[model samples]
Target: MFYWLLKYVVLGPVLKCLFRPDVTGLEHVPATGPVILACNHLSFSDSIFTPLIVKRKVTFVAKAEYFTGKGIKGWLMRQFFVGTGTIPVDRSGGKAARAALDTQLRVLLAGSIAGIYPEGTRSPDGRLYRGKTGVARLALESGAPVVPVALLNTDEIQPTGKLIPKIKRVRLRFGAPLDFCRYSGSVGDRFVERAVTDEIMYELMTLTGREYVDVYAASLKTSVEAPRPAAGAFEPLEDRAR
Candidate 1:
């Protein structure tokens, strides 16, 4: 298939030879099992190099537009995402957000590793943002072990909005797997999900050592002239609910 071909034939060999990405704690990855590889999002290339360095296929929950785009560039992107085993997700959130979790569950139940960014989207600024409960919901619902992964120096290789990335050595660090079996049957409990999500964010923050911002990344993109919440008051995490 295109996935294996690209990995072993085309891009894989080139990436491995060029950057020779460094990885630590790789032994933490289970030899075989359904697990969640929760990673910090730094650059768009984080998606590419994250899986390239791992032994198992890491299915990322990418935006649907990558698969639905048009024209020659669209065709190439669609093929790349598909060949890389990336799942298209609607970032609209709410019911759509739950749907994305369901899709990830399907991948988990099949015993494949699902790669997810707890931040929900790439950080416009590099600081870490609060994680969404969907990751907690997925973890509890499927009972998969969560491995915190840190991808370093990828932003330098391919920064935001750049089409081509220069060759640069990168680091991929995998952390201890976290088990939330105590909260397994407690799905839909807002308190429990928030507790679990915060725990996951703490792990990511610890691994990456990035400053933690208590808000979603998208909210920071709003126009300065847009209606703003009162000082010291921000949208509740449950309002956006993804």
Candidate 2:
């Protein structure tokens, strides 16, 4: 299998030697079974490093554009993502959301780990942003436990537009798995979805110790001005938890 070969034999050894990543709470990840790894989106390297560090394969859904680029660079990019088992989702149509969910559900239902970034997009700043509810939807639909993962200092290694990552120490922290069986059969309920997403974001905030912004990260990246937040828009996770 190309996945195992790349992970254990080819790329894994090189990455381990280069990053020397310090990971903690790895025991929280279930050794086997369907599990959802809901991690905060930092750098593009988050995709590469997290999978390399985790023992099991983590299937992630990436933007379709990454797989449809032109030229030799595009070919290499497509090959890398495809080789690593990344699914490409065209986030353009009204059905895009459902398609991505379905893809992830299939992976989870097959007793595999599905890695998702609930924030929808990477944080424009280093601060943590509000998470989207798709992660909660996946958990409820697939009956899988959600593990909150925090990737620290990855943005520094590869900032938003940086092609190559600078050699730096990377850190990952995995929190205890969150069981949502109490909300079984509540997959499409918006209120319940929001609650679950907020809970996951809170855990990520605590783990990364980053300032929590109540705004969606993608909105801030767009040219359209993001609406101003209220007086207490940014707050410490401890204070916000109250």
What TM-score would every model get versus the actual structure? 0.89, 0.91
- Taken over the whole model, the C-alpha lDDT of each candidate is 0.83, 0.87
- lDDT string for model 2 (122-208, tens) is 877777899989999999999999999998778777877889899987878999999999999997899999999999999999988
lDDT of 1 by residue, 1-242 (tens): 88889998999999999988878889888889899999988788899998898888889989998898899999999999999989888888788877878989999999999999999888766777888888898899899999999875676677677888878777778999999998868989999999998998898888776668898877775533223223213222332253
- Give me the displacement of residue 93 in model 2, in angstroms: 5.6
**Model 1 weakest 10-residue run by lDDT:** 227-236
Whole-structure CA lDDT of model 1: 0.83
TM-score of 2: 0.91
Say what the RMSD of model 2 is.
Answer: 4.8
RMSD of each: 7.6, 4.8
